[model samples]
Target chain A: MRIGELSRRTGVPVPTIKYYLREGLVPHGERTSPNQARYDEAHVHRVRLVRALTEVGGLSIAAARDVLALMHEPGRGRLGSIGKVHFAVQAARQPHTDEPSESSVARTNDLIEQRGWHVRPTNPARAALAGVLDYFTRLGQPDVLGLLDDYADAAEKLAVAEIDTLGGRDVDHMAEHVVMMTVLGGALLNALRGLAQESAASAKMT
Target chain B: MRIGELSRRTGVPVPTIKYYLREGLVPHGERTSPNQARYDEAHVHRVRLVRALTEVGGLSIAAARDVLALMHEPGRGRLGSIGKVHFAVQAARQPHTDEPSESSVARTNDLIEQRGWHVRPTNPARAALAGVLDYFTRLGQPDVLGLLDDYADAAEKLAVAEIDTLGGRDVDHMAEHVVMMTVLGGALLNALRGLAQESAASAKMT
Candidate 1:
């Protein structure tokens, strides 16, 4: 297969494919001649993953490269790759606020202790949660704090399901699955929340 | 009661406050002189809301302006403001993928019907869900679809809580609450999910 066929198959344009090649997002095809290159099944798979990351996952080229590097690393297990991918994904979501408050940190720590969650305070996700709480505190919306337990319950259930699914997959397969779920899972959850809000509001009306 | 005081109180920079004022994200203060403007407590509140929308929500200036417009409109209730703010916020989250597959659309419609959700098929959130599912199908990861019911369950619970809280607030307060929850809620949920994942993984080790 050639670049043209790859483009047609993946729905990614030829120039975008070239751009990914230049950015090292996709591996270069074999140079068959001065003007021709040949791709293989592996290239097809790689290109598709690239599209998923960039287009669906909304990851930048740099982040996508980091994720792909982790995925392609030889002998990397599912857990290791998931941790790395999780870190990379967090680093990629640009943070807009400055330092969080001490109260926010205390609240997050308390939540973790109460729930017995295994994540360390140093985890970026913990900081992310603290930031939201801090902003709420600043804005005087303490009522929003009441929803934490419910959110945690839902989140815990989701994590168990995700981890169980990860247990059955091979390392190679696990890499893509981890990235896709971690990246797009937020969007899916959010969209469903929006739909659910409508339903809730409708129920109230009746 | 000056711009400097508003900045000092909100932790937003003086230049950023001016920028927001110039961009119409925050309402202009009363002109006291050719170069001096006197702000009030309301100014402080508006500036904080603007910061939340732009910084935490990652909404563009234009979208923030639109959201603020809806918020400031006279006699607009919480329900009306939520619909408008939801529209503005959705417009701000730039979609990376193109049109979704027919199957994706059909599947989303089926989910809404099966769940008896009150949302219409044309809701942007439904399209967003279909787009995620379509990406999953394209990536040959139909297994991700299996988590839809669980995700919906979580989403519905959160929505019920959110709407319940909204019922107790006045229109003025509801405007800010709706935006904050809708924007920062995703971050909070994602962070909790990350913590829960770590907990699940740790349990496996033990």
Candidate 2:
């Protein structure tokens, strides 16, 4: 298949595909002639993955590129690969300017200790969580803070369920599966939360 | 206090404060003279809210403005206000171009019905959920689809916990609280999930 067919199959425009190719997001197609190149199923898969990351997952091209590069690198143990992907995705989503206060960081550490979660100290999610706690503190909303344990409980359950589903997967597709479940799974969970909030609010009203 | 004082208090820069005033994101302070205007706590609060929505919530300027406007509106019951806010936030976050397929829409509806959730059909989350399902279908990941019910269970639990925390709040502050929890809570939940995934992955590895 040529670039045209690749575009057709993926529903991405030709110019956008060229731009992705230039950005090294999608690997270059085979050189068939002076003016033509051929793409394959791998090209289609790569294009779709890139689109899913940038479009649905809302990662920047640079971030998506980094994730793709990580996916292709071999010899990282399963835990190492998962940790790196989590770090990459979480770091990309969190802004650098919002420094979490020492108090907020302490609160986050306290939560970790209470939950006995074995996350690394430098995990980006720790800072991200502290950032939110800091924001709530600024807003003077203690009620929201009181629900932290419940949120953690829900998060732990979902995480365990997500990991349980990973048993017996083909090693060849594990990286891709991890990326999809991490990125798209966040979106899916958020969407479901929105719907559930609506239902809960309505149930409270009447 | 003057505009400079307001800027100092909120930690928003003077020029940015002026821009917010011009954008009507923050109401104008009373003019003390031709050269000066005095701001109060309300102005300070509005500026902070706008920053939270735009910076922390990742809403566009237009979306932030809309949410601010909703925060000030009167006479909508608690559920109505909550519903509108959820709709606005979800609609703003989801792209208009990604139309959900019929099958995905059916799947989302089935989940809602199975859960006996009382959300409206027009709720943007329904479409957002369907969009994610469609993306998963395109990626050919049945492993992910199998976890939909688990995701919903987690979402439902969190939603109920959040709403339960809302009892006895002053009516005047309810709108602001809802907006903050809905937006910042999503960020908080996502961050927590990331941490939990790390812990779960590590536990499995060991």
Candidate 3:
């Protein structure tokens, strides 16, 4: 595929694709000639992933670049698998299924504890959500860190919900059923609470 | 109190306070002399409110100015109450005790019906969280539009577990708990879901 074909498939403009290429965010295409470059499926997928990360996941270009780098890391060993999970879940959502067996949970638990610790806290949001790691330890499940890493990637450091309680950490996937309910739920709760406060303030004034 | 005192109490920077005053985001302090002005507790509170609405609520200065204008609008009756709810909920949050009575619920229902419309879909976020809303509606009661306008808040929107979904509009204070739970719960669920997804995806690829 050429640049136009790639553009047609991904809905990203040719200029924007050039921009991503220039930024080194997108991989270089095969050279067809001195002036032309040949693109492929990898280019298509890469653009889609980039678009989702920046637009849907609401990550900055720099953040999206870092996340892509993390995803592209070697996946041969346990570390690779862990890295893949970190990359995918941070951007794409996993739909729910039935409950897992004790053994599956155990493997997930172990994988989370072992390789997950490699993800250092990049921001206070992840740092705050790191609090949940202790809770997971108590529950005999250490995978919360991996989940938190994934979350930190997707949610962009909503850790201030733990601190000042005024920061915006709205979930990225309002498309997912679980996420939407939570957003609406927050909205409704926030509304009634305000109504109640207003009533109280007026009562006092009266 | 001088602007410095207001700054000390509200923790807003002196420069920002001067900006707010000059921008008319805050009323000009009473001039004590050619260069001196005095503010009061009311000024301090208003500044804090303005900051909360602008910073946390993510409203532009012009937008915040417009919202504050509605807040100061006297004798708008129920519209006045709606503005109060709008501002209060947007400023992070606060807890409340006085639940709406059956009468209040009925009043809201009548007002919503009379408006010949549902909730004005206040936030642009609705398009994102539609999936969660579908999930919630499928489980039981499906009156989100009715309740959304009745609440007209971001934080008040929420998700209840299948077992705990609020059944009726008339339940006093029920909306607050449900909505708060929804936002916080959604955040938690998204975090967990992100984990589940990462775990599942890693297992397959690695």
- The digit string of per-residue lDDT tens for model 2 on B1-206 reads 99889988878899999998898899888898998999988888788778778877778889988877877778645556756766887777663337788999998989999999998878888888898887788888888999998899989998998888777786667778888888788888888988898888788878
**Model 1, stretches more than 4 Å misplaced?**
none
Please identify which of the two predictions, 2 or 3, would achieve the higher DockQ against the true structure. 2
Clashes of 2: 0
Cα lDDT tens digits, model 1, B5-68, are: 8888999999999899889888788999999999988888788778777877767788888878
- Pairs that collide, model 2: none
Give i-RMS (Å) per prediction: 1.8, 1.6, 14.7
Summing lDDT over every window of 10 consecutive residues in candidate 3 chain A, give the lowest-scoring window: A158-167
Which numbered prediction scores highest in DockQ against the true structure?
A: 2
DockQ of 1: 0.67
Clashing pairs in 1: none
Q: Write the per-residue lDDT of candidate 1 for residues A32-130, one digit (tens) a residue.
A: 999889998888778878877776556679888987898778766746556776666665563466677888888889989998888855567777788
In model 1 chain B, where is the ten-residue run with the lowest total lDDT? B87-96
Residues A87-129, model 2: lDDT tens digits? 8867777643367889999989998888989988789889989
Error of 1 at A205 (Å): 2.2
TM-score of chain A of each: 0.90, 0.93, 0.45
